[model samples]
Target: MTVNRFLIPAFAAALLGAFGLIAAAQAQTGPLRIEITEGVIEPLPFAVPDFVDEGGAGEYARNVARVIASDLSGTGLFREIPREAHISRVTSFDSSIAFEDWKAINAQAVITGAVTVSGDRIVVKFRLFDVFSGQQLGEGLQFAGTTQSWRRMAHKVADAAYSRITGEGGYFDTRVVFVSESGPKNNRLKRLAVMDYDGANVQYLTDSSSIVLAPRFSPTGDRILYTSYESGFPRITLMDVGSLRTQALAEQPGTMTFAPRFSPDGSRVVFSLERGGNSDLYMLDIGSGGLQQLTNAPSIETAPSFSPDGSQIVFESDRSGTQQLYIMPAGGGEGRRISGGQGRYGTPVWSPRGDMIAFTKQHQGRFHIGVMRTDGSEERLLTASFLDEGPTWAPNGRVIMFTRETSGAGGQAALYSVDISGRNLRQIPTEGAASDPAWSPLLP
Candidate 1:
C-alpha cells in the first residue's frame, strides 16, 4: 500500500478550471428537473447445498465445502441458508435442480458441487443458480489437483461465482502475508506467516529466532520483501516463495532500515533508513544493486509508498513540527507537505486506485483510519477505536485492513478490515498475535 499527497493551491485551481468550461457549455441547454428516488431494500438470501462425494478418500472433500460457506458468510453480503432447511439434494452434476424447493426457503440463489476421486487427483465440479429466476447463472467449473489443493479449489469456485454476480473481483481466492507475534511485548517472537484470506491453511515462512516486520507481497504474488533482524541488526531481505530461498538486500553501516515496499512493477524496493539520528526514505535497484537516497530531511521520515504509476512517492515525515504526509519524485528530490489538519498523521499508504491515500491519524488522543484525496481534500474517517494502525488497502480500493490492540494486560492484537462506507466490519482470525497485515493482489 502507498499514500499520495498533492499541493492544494495548484491542484484546486486545475480542478475548478476543468469544471468551469463544462458547466458553461451545458447552461445553454433546455431546462430539466432531476428527481431523487427513495425506497426500502433487502439483501438477497442464498443457499449452499452440501457438496456430494462420489468416493470418500480425502478429508478435504468434506472440509473444503464448509470453508467456502464460511468465506461467503464473512463478507456480510450473502446469507447462506442452512442445510437443514434445504429442500432438495444434488447427487450429480448432470441432474436438474429443483428451483421450487429453494424458493420455498426464501433463497434467491443456490450453489451445488460434486467431489470425486480419480487415482491420486481430486476432481470437483460446481454450479451456481439463481433460484428466483429459475436459471443457471453461469457455466459450471471443473478443477483437478492433489487433495492438498482442495482448499484452493474451493476458494476459486467461490471467487468465480462472486465475480460473475457482482461484476467485481473476489478476494476469497487470495492470501495474506502478515507478521505473527508471540511471547512478551518487550522480548517478542516474530516471524513471517502466510494464510488463506479466510484464515485457513496457515504456514510460517520464517522461524521465530529472528524478528520480522512489514511483510509485503510482490505484485505477482510469487515473492515477498520484509525487514528482518536476523543478523543482530535490522536489514531488508527478499524471499522467493517457490524455492524458499532468501538473500540480503543492501548493506548500510550503523543505520536501521524498516517499512519496505515493492514498486508497482516489482523491479525495485523502497524503504526507510535511519542514519546519524535521522530517518529518510531510500530506494534500492533490485537488478543492479545500486543504492539511491530519496530524502534528505532532518526529521524522522519513514513509511515510503509508491503511486500506482510508479512516478511519485508518498511518505510520513515530522519535518513540519508534527508527523504529516509528503510527496516527492520517485528518484529523490525536494518534497512538499500536503497534510495541514489539526493533528499528527502516520502510516501514509496509497490506494491501488491512484485517487486517494489511507492512513492512521491521531487527533485528541484517539486513533482513526481515514482516507484523503491526492490533494488532501475529502478526508473521510472509516474507523476509530482504542488503537488502530497500519492501514492496508484492498485490491479494489473499496476496503482497508488494519490491526487493533485492546487496552490493559492480557490484551491481544488482531487483524480487521472495514469498508470505506463505514460498514461491514469483520475480525479476521490469526493463529496467534498478529500485526502489520499486508493484503496481496488478486491471485492469477
Candidate 2:
C-alpha cells in the first residue's frame, strides 16, 4: 500500500543522506521525517503489522513487532496506527509492498519484519519505508540472538529505525541501574536494581538487607559501582554484573567513600571520600589498586563524572562558597567554576557526547533538573518540582532521567525523563518508588 509522507525542513536533508532515503526531490510525495525542537510537532504516523513468523515462532513474531511499536511510540516522536484500522496485512517475509494501501490510511511510514526460529535461536529482519514515496528508508537490517534475548533484538530494530529518521543515536537498547525503594517512607528499604531503559526486565543485584545508593554502571556496562552501607558506613562497592561478585574499594580506616563513577575507559573510578569533617574527590585505578586525591578542599566536593574522553572531570563542589559545578583535569587540579547562576547546583553528570552537562539545581525553594554546555554557557532548566535531583543522561545525551520526590511525611520518590529541549517530561514506569537512576551505555 502507498503512504504519504512530508519531510520536515529542519532535519530532512541530513536524515535523507544518513539513511539513504530514496525519495526523489521532484516526486509528488515526500519522505516522512520529524523536526525535533522545543515546540510541539505532530508525531509521525506509522504502522507495524505483526511480524511474519517463518516457523515455530508462534507468539514471538507478534511480540517482537509489539515491542518495536512500543519503543518507537514511547518516544513521543512517532504514532502507531492501530492494527484494527489496517487495510493491508503482511502475509509473508518477502511480500511485495502495497504502498497505495498504506497511503489510504494516511500513514507516513511503515515498518515490516519477519521472525524466524531455529532450535533455541531467533533472527529478526526488518525494513522501514516511506510509503508515500514508494521507497525504503534505511538499509536492511537483522538481529540474531538466543530465544531468551528476543526483547533486546526487538529493541535493536527500533533503535535502527529511530536513528535513521532522527539522525540521532537511539537509546532504546540501553539499561538503567537505580535504587529500588520499598516499605514506609520513614524506614524505606533500598537495593540495587537494574532494568531495561523502559523499566522492563527488572533484576535486583543486591538485596535490601543493606541499603544501596547511587548505583552507576561502568562504561562497558559489565560492572557497577555504588555506595553500600553493609559495613556500617557508606563504602564504595564494585560488582561484576554477570557473576554478582562484590568488592569494596577505597577502604580507608577512618574515611567514608561514596558517589563513585567510572571513567570512560572503565579502568578508573572517581568518587568522594569523607574524613574528619571534610569531603573531597578521589580517583582509584582499578587494576593496580592505586589511589589519588583530586581535591583537598575544606568544603564538600562530590558527584564526580568523567568526560567521554576521560580527560576532564565535572563535579559538584562547595569550595566556591556555595554548591556549584566545576570542571577539572582528570589528573587533579584547581578546576574553574562553570555554573554562575543564582542557584545551588549538585549531582553534575557529563553527557556521553561530552557536549553538555546535566545537573541538579535548587533556587528559590524549587528544585530543578537542568543542562548546560561544557563551557557553562546556554544553561537551560529542563524540569522543576518540589524535589528533583540526580540527573543521568541517556546513551545519546538527548534525554535525561532524574529522581523527583514529593513533599510531606508520606513523600515518595520516582523516576522521570525529559528531552534536553525540556519537552516530553514524563514519569518512568517502575515497580514502585525508585530513585538515583543511572543509564548504562548502549548494549554492544
TM agreement with the true structure for every prediction: 0.86, 0.93
lDDT of 2 by residue, 179-245 (tens): 9999898799999999999999999999899889999999899999999999999999999999999
**Total clashes in model 2, counting residue pairs 3 or more apart in sequence or in different chains:** 11
User: Model 2 — which ten-residue stretch has the worst lDDT?
Assistant: 18-27
lDDT of each: 0.77, 0.87
Clashes of 1: 4
RMSD list, candidates in order: 8.4, 4.4
Q: Report lDDT (Cα) of residue 259, candidate 2.
A: 94
Model 1 alpha-carbon miss at residue 107, Å: 1.2
Candidate 1: residue pairs that collide = 2-349, 2-350, 3-349, 3-350
With candidate 1 superimposed using the best TM-score fit, by how many Å does residue 400's alpha carbon deviate from the native?
A: 2.3
Shift in Å, residue 361, candidate 1: 1.5
